[model samples]
Target: MNSATDVEIHAIKQVVATVEHAQRYELVEEFVSLFREDAIWTTAAGRLLIGRDAIAAFTWQVLPGAMKDLVPSYEVVHVLFIRPDVAAAKVRQRYFFPDGEPVTEEGGAPRCT
Candidate 1:
């Protein structure tokens, strides 16, 4: 693996920011738009979602009002460049109550990366 350029790092951060924004606002389309057509997404629940259509279906069913009393935060902790055009980003995800207390135990809520 090669070290990512500053520009690449910034782009990864922007993608994470977009995810945070989409989740915070429950914008399903915006969230799903981030995935490639062949992307595979594994949910926090350990469900394996294959392909963009599968992801969209699952997200559509769950994202609306999912954050009614909570806020989600996503931060890009690391990015590994596998090739010039491919990178894997590790994101830290946390959920908080409207009053800002971390949702420590909701649905087996452990800090996710």
Candidate 2:
């Protein structure tokens, strides 16, 4: 990985660790930390959730309920720069639910909900 990709991947890893192991409140900040101040996050449903504050609020609302599973495993399939200032990636994640439902695959808003 190039330096930029390495940094972004590292940032993602830190957020994942915080989300899985830290309290929900602690994760709110950690999630935002992975995003740029002017980041534009688009939901898979095509909703435009903009900026850090908006993202943080959105994260706080659904994190505890939908993300209490905490421990999740993801593979970064690809990361390509859209421009010098923009980059995007494709990730696949699997969650091992505590309820013993076996491994579940979830992404986008469904995971957030």
Candidate 3:
């Protein structure tokens, strides 16, 4: 791989790592720190959150106790560079119990737009 590609991957991995860490520990502040001040996020259930404040509010409300027995894994399946600093990533994510049983059912996965 070229150095440019390697750099991009490394940068994106940092973002993913932060996300995973926040989710694993349910750290609302740390998770919210990853987003831009003007960023927008939509929940899997279709609620739209605009800006970091909105995202932080929502995250703090639900992250606690939401994954008491579930472990989530996120894989970056594809990454498309739109520009030198902008890219789109396709992620495959799923949840499983600590014992390794998959959580397969409706509402088990989140939809990202």
Rank order (by TM-score, best first)? 3, 1, 2
lDDT for each of the candidates?
0.85, 0.61, 0.81
Against the true structure, whose TM-score is highest? 3
Window of ten residues with lowest summed lDDT in model 1: 104-113
Residues 1-113, model 3: lDDT tens digits = 78998899878877887887788788889999999999999775778999999999999998998678878777677888889788998766677778988776432364333
**TM-score of every prediction relative to native:** 0.85, 0.58, 0.88
Put down candidate 2 lDDT per residue, 1-113, tens digits, no spaces.
68977887777555555544433344566667777889887754576899988878877775565556644555566667777666676666555556645354453333344
Model 2 clashes, total count: 0
Residue-level lDDT for 101 in candidate 1: 85
Best by lDDT: 1
What's model 3's lDDT at 69?
Answer: 81
107 Cα displacement, candidate 2 (Å): 6.1
Off by over 4 Å in 2: 1-26, 44-46, 81-87, 99-113
Candidate 1 residue runs with Cα over 4 Å from true position: 1-4, 105-113
For candidate 2, the TM-score is 0.58
